[model samples]
Target: MDPAAEAARRLEADPSMLLCGPLSVLHAVLDVVVRAYGEAAETVRAALDRLEDRVLAALACRPHRGHPLPGARGP
Candidate 1:
């Protein structure tokens, strides 16, 4: 059941227990939001790890040549 609807049902069932029902609903929603954020963080972390690995591999395959600055003395 939807969180809002469930909370409404609780409120309607007992009008006097005002704070308790709504607080429970709020807690449930926050829990879902937090979990979603955690999943997103993990996804971004994996993507960055893959990008770093690809970049390092590409750099390793290239031959190193020191390019002297223009008009500067070369050894």
Candidate 2:
């Protein structure tokens, strides 16, 4: 569930949260937000890793160029 909904559910399910003060509520919300961000970051990192692996594999399959004379002072 989304952070707001989760926080609301927590508050409703546990009335003591309201008596703890606003900071407690804020902490609960922030905790959810932080966890969501961490999950998203991990997803992105895994995708990038897969992409890098594919690129490296493709490059490894290609033949190397033996000639280079575009702007060289060849002997």
Candidate 3:
């Protein structure tokens, strides 16, 4: 599954757990910081931040460089 889909599955499977993990510590600190600086916004900026690196690293992809298919062009 794709990263977005996986994340959605995670959120659906266990929302509280997804948001309440150790990552929540950083989120909580951001929440406090936002409140402190009085930033106005509909959603937390952190949510907009891309966690793609961590997410993708967790979901390792299949390597496809060496195993070329039959009739495939060669360099």
Candidate 4:
């Protein structure tokens, strides 16, 4: 089963836990949201790092390399 579904099932098994009032519920949801945001930011950072490494490698290996790379000139 999916992890989200499993979490939902666990929550459903204890419906009373949902009665912890608005503040508690709001905190729980915000905690999850913040954690997910952090995970996403890390994923994006890793991807961008990889892209930067690749671009640097390509530039270093290019023959007749010049400053300011292709298409980087100001209008």
Candidate 5:
């Protein structure tokens, strides 16, 4: 984001996190694309989105170890 516009955009849009605007735009495009593919496609797309979100959550929670993340520990 352009630094100059950041303040103004934040004031007007009031995004909860810095990612809200971009994620909102992506969500719109995804909605259209998924709806076009019908119910089964929508289900698959939602599942993929959920999985992607989980992966992102995991990545965000852990520290990056040696550039690539370390392997998960065994139970």
Candidate 6:
């Protein structure tokens, strides 16, 4: 399941979560949020890495060019 849904399910499944006091409940919620953020960051990093590899590969396959004026003669 997705992170948000999973986090909610976890919070809901544990009835004791509410009895732990505001601070403890807050900590649990924050922990879930942080984990979700970390997962999202990893996904973004992987996508960027794939994009960079494709761009580099395309550049590598391009033909090299010589100097533009190599064949020019004095006017």
TM-score of each: 0.61, 0.73, 0.25, 0.57, 0.38, 0.61
Which prediction has more favorable TM-score, 3 or 4? 4
Worst 10 residues of 6 by lDDT: 1-10
**Cα lDDT listed for each candidate:** 0.74, 0.89, 0.57, 0.70, 0.64, 0.77
Pairs that collide, model 1: none
Best by TM-score: 2
RMSD for all candidates, in order, please.
Answer: 5.7, 2.8, 18.5, 6.8, 18.5, 5.6
The reply for model 3, stretches above 4 Å from the true place, is: 1-19, 39-75
lDDT of 3 by residue, 15-67 (tens): 68456776754454555556645543534465445566667766676454587
| Candidate 5 lDDT, 7-51, residue by residue in tens | 455444745543676765555455545555687687899999999
Model 6: per-residue Cα lDDT over 1-75, one tens digit each:
354566557768886776767765566667888887898899999999999999999989999765558778756
- Position 50, candidate 2: lDDT: 100
Pairing residues by index, what is the TM-score of model 1? 0.61
Worst 10 residues of 5 by lDDT: 1-10
Instruction: Report the C-alpha lDDT of model 4 over 1-75, residue by residue, as the tens digit.
Output: 344554455457767757776654555556566777898899999999999999999988979744686779755
Q: After superposing candidate 2, which stretches have Cα over 4 Å from the reference?
A: 10-19, 66-75
Backbone clashes in model 4: 0
Task: Sort the predicted structures by lDDT, highest score first.
Answer: 2, 6, 1, 4, 5, 3
Q: List the residue pairs that clash in candidate 6.
A: none
lDDT of 4 at 20: 74
Instruction: Arrange candidates, best TM-score first.
Output: 2, 6, 1, 4, 5, 3
